[model samples]
Target: MNIALSNTSDKPIYQQLFERISAQILKGELENGYCLPPIRQAAQELSISVITVKKAWEELERCGLIHTITGKGCFVAELSSDRKLQIRDEMISKQMLLDTSYYKSFGLTLDDVIAMLKKVY
Candidate 1:
């Protein structure tokens, strides 16, 4: 697994870990049945707390992006292409809801947001 952690970001370390790994798994960059490193190893490599990596792994399992086997570590879940798209859309939609709320609070319209996104994206 590849990860880059930002201590300065507003998001917690565990959340960043979860989002990046999940995106990788959904994008097929991390193939189905790929075994993730154990939590302690991941934490040590990432220079973060073991508890944080464990939390992120748990969230991945909770979202059905990965599954754990006793003594075997966690592996990426096997998912159909359609299911991957579905999960990706669901995750994006949830983030969009939060982003839209933030934009609205700033009095930005959909067009304004789209325009800004176009420039950044």
Candidate 2:
């Protein structure tokens, strides 16, 4: 339910919203069945477009992180600890694939990337 959007980030606004919300849900910061603000309300509060909020919500549902009920609003899905860890690993693996590809294009080895990541992380 808490989010801080970065206008200068390379990622789109909707993507930023989706990532933040999903991370919270997976980390149990947002409990199972917790109601998310309506798309229009969230858009207004975040000063973003309604369409952006809608897209992020749609992504959450698509990823099985949340579900929507007609007239009831979207709620976080019930996830066990194992399921949360699985989803976290899956998401991280996917992102790492892309990052590895990017690093490879720059001729950076795994050790080089790890060193750089350590510095930033």
Candidate 3:
């Protein structure tokens, strides 16, 4: 697993970690049953606190992306293709809901937003 942490980012370290890992899992970059490193080891390697990594791992578990097994480590959950697509859409729609609210605040219509998105995208 690969992760890049940004201290300068507005998001907290744990949140960043959670997002990166979840993205990888959803995209099938981290296949089902792939074992994640222990929290302490990950913390040492990433030079972050154990609590941060733990929090991120907890979030991953909460989201059903990873499962922890006693004596073994955390492993990516087996997800169907349809489930992956459902999760991808859910995540994107959530972000879009927030973005849509922001756009509405600026008095931008859907067409205007789509146009801007097209340009940037």
Candidate 4:
């Protein structure tokens, strides 16, 4: 697993971690049953607090994105394609709504948003 923390961003480190891992799972970058490093090990590797990593892992579990086994560590959950797509759309749509609200506050039109999205997408 790979994650980059942004200390300057409004998002917490754990939230960033959760989003990255969630994206990987939904995109099939992380396959079902793929085991993740232990929280302590992942924290050491990322130079983040163990608590932060633990919270992220917990959030992944809360979202049904990962499953934990006693003593075995966390693994990506097995999911049907339809279920994966459902979660993916739900997460993406929620974030998109938050972003669109910001843009709307700035009086940006849908065309303006499309133009901006086009630049990166």
Candidate 5:
């Protein structure tokens, strides 16, 4: 599992971790049963607190993207293609809602947003 952490980001470290891992799982980049490093090890490697990595792992488990087995480790959850698509859409929809609200606050209409998105995308 690969992740990049940004100290300057507005989001908390754990949130950044959770989002990146979720995206990878949803994209099938992390296959089912993929083992995740222990929280302490991940924290040491990332130079972050173990608590941060633990929180992110907990979030992933809460989202049904991973499962933890006592004495073993955490692993990516097996999901059908349709389920993956569903989760991906749900995640994107949540982010889009926030983005749309931000654009609306800037007085950007749907067309303006779409045009900008087209260019950037």
Candidate 6:
């Protein structure tokens, strides 16, 4: 597994770790049963505090993307294709709502948002 952490990021180190790792897992870059590095190891590798790694790992577990085994380490959870799609959609939809709300707050109309999205796509 690989990750890049930005020191000047607005997001916390743990959240940045969590989002990137989770996105990688969802993209099948991290296979089922693949064990993530230990908290201390990951922290050392990333040059961040171990507590940050621990917090991110706990969040991945909370999202059901991984599971921790006693005396071992966390492994990516096996998910069915349908389940993967469901989880992916749920995650994407949540982000979309947040993004849309931001646009709405800026007084952007549906047509305005669609046009902007079209330009990007």
How many clashes (backbone N, Cα, C below 3 Å) per candidate? Answer: 0, 0, 0, 0, 0, 0
Once superposed on the true structure, which residue ranges of model 3 sit more than 4 Å away at CA?
none
lDDT of 3: 0.94
Q: Which stretch of 10 consecutive residues in model 5 shows the poorest summed lDDT?
A: 83-92
Q: What digit string (tens of lDDT, one per residue) describes model 4 on residues 10-118?
A: 9999999999999999999999999999999999999999999999999999989999999898999999989999999999999999999999999999999999999
Estimate the lDDT of model 2: 0.93
Query: What TM-score number comes out for model 4?
Result: 0.92
lDDT, model 5: 0.94
Query: Which pairs clash in model 2?
Result: none
Q: Order of all candidates by lDDT, from best down to worst?
A: 1, 4, 5, 3, 2, 6
Q: Worst ten-residue run, lDDT, model 6?
A: 79-88
RMSD of each: 1.2, 1.5, 1.2, 1.3, 0.8, 1.3
Clashes of 6: 0
Candidate 4 steric clashes: 0
Question: For model 5, what is the error of residue 95's alpha carbon versus the real structure, in angstroms, after optimal superposition?
Answer: 1.1
lDDT (C-alpha, whole model) for all candidates: 0.95, 0.93, 0.94, 0.95, 0.94, 0.92
lDDT of 3 by residue, 42-92 (tens): 999999999999999999998888999999999999999898889888888
TM per candidate comes to 0.93, 0.90, 0.92, 0.92, 0.96, 0.91
* lDDT, candidate 3, at 35: 98
**Regarding lDDT, does 2 or 5 come out ahead?**
5
Which runs in model 2 stand beyond 4 Å of their true positions?
A: none
